[model samples]
Target: MASGSPLQPTLGELIASLSLQLTTLVKGEVELAKAQVAEKGKSMGLGIGLFVGAGLFGFFAFAVLIATAVLGIATALPAWLSALIVGVALLLFAGLLAFVGKKSLDKAKEVKPEPVANLKQDIEIVKDGFTS
Candidate 1:
């Protein structure tokens, strides 16, 4: 038989060849996973950048709307007084939101997760069993 004949590989040679193929397959899979993750990360970054741009535009639009309201009110009241009224109203709304948020946070602080409570009870039962 020829030295290079496929039908005559030694056991050691066959094992070596299998190991090389497995190594190559694993390396290829790792490379593919890295490439997929990189593509997803790029897409996520772009999406986040677009969201930030949208938020900035929304903020400008809100400022413009507030300006329009001030200008509309200026038709009846002095410009300074109208601006002050709008500012005070905005502060009051912000304060109300802060109060509600604080209350919600306080309520959240009072609550405990069931799993944590169960775990603590289980630990105490184990301790009691050991003591008894």
Candidate 2:
């Protein structure tokens, strides 16, 4: 053996270093993706919360409007009977909507674990390559 530059690395050392760097790169990429997904999830959750809040308020507004309409109708008809008739009709409409919504939900596809599946496939392929 002869003296060499301090910067020089043996073949095995170089390969080890490359492997370490590749591992770091993959870890960094995965972490970055996780962060991005977390951020998007937070935003999506906030948006959904806001929409639900709006929907709740809208439902209350709709109820108030319905009550007003029923009271207006009561000017000619009996107030109690007017309210009962409107309430029955509203219940029927809501029942129809609920049935339709249930059918739609039943027909909807379940959330697929596509990312995890792809990652598993990739790992398997890499494992196979190494084994071969």
Candidate 3:
């Protein structure tokens, strides 16, 4: 039974079928990548939210500890002056942390320019093909 006798595909038809399958495979891969990226973004958002909540609770706990320390020291000094001293110290510490945090955030903002450069190089390579 030669191809096209109602049994097998002809060579042209086989090529056309292969092309269609390749297109479908590429489309399916692109869709899978999109779904994975979406899921990762959702997980990252939830993780960031939990981190923020934990940081807030940690700050509250620190405040309570500061208050306790101030109250403990009040027996040796006047309560109001003790509180004022502790508050000033805390303010100075907070300012230092803010300064360091600002520097850290600035560094974070500039993280990994190399990845972008590499992506651009990859685009150029793809555009130029294997010649150079």
How high is the lDDT of residue 113 in model 3?
Answer: 72
Write down the RMSD of candidate 2 (Cα, Å). Answer: 9.8
lDDT of candidate 1 over 15-101, digit per residue (tens):
999999999999999999999999999999999999999999999999999899899999999999999999999999999999999
Query: Residue by residue across 1-132, what tens digits does model 2's lDDT show?
Result: 465567898777889999999999999999999999999999999999999999999999998999998999899899999999899999999999999998888777565559988999999999999999
Clashes in each model (backbone N, CA, C under 3 Å)? Answer: 0, 0, 0
1 or 2, greater by TM-score: 1
Q: By summed lDDT, which 10 consecutive residues of candidate 3 come out lowest?
A: 1-10
TM agreement with the true structure for every prediction: 0.80, 0.63, 0.66
For candidate 3, write residues 55-117 as lDDT tens digits. 999999988999998998898999999999998998999999999999999999988578888
For model 2 the local lDDT of residue 97 reads 100
* Global fold similarity of model 3 (TM-score): 0.66
Consecutive 10-residue window with the lowest summed lDDT within model 1 = 1-10
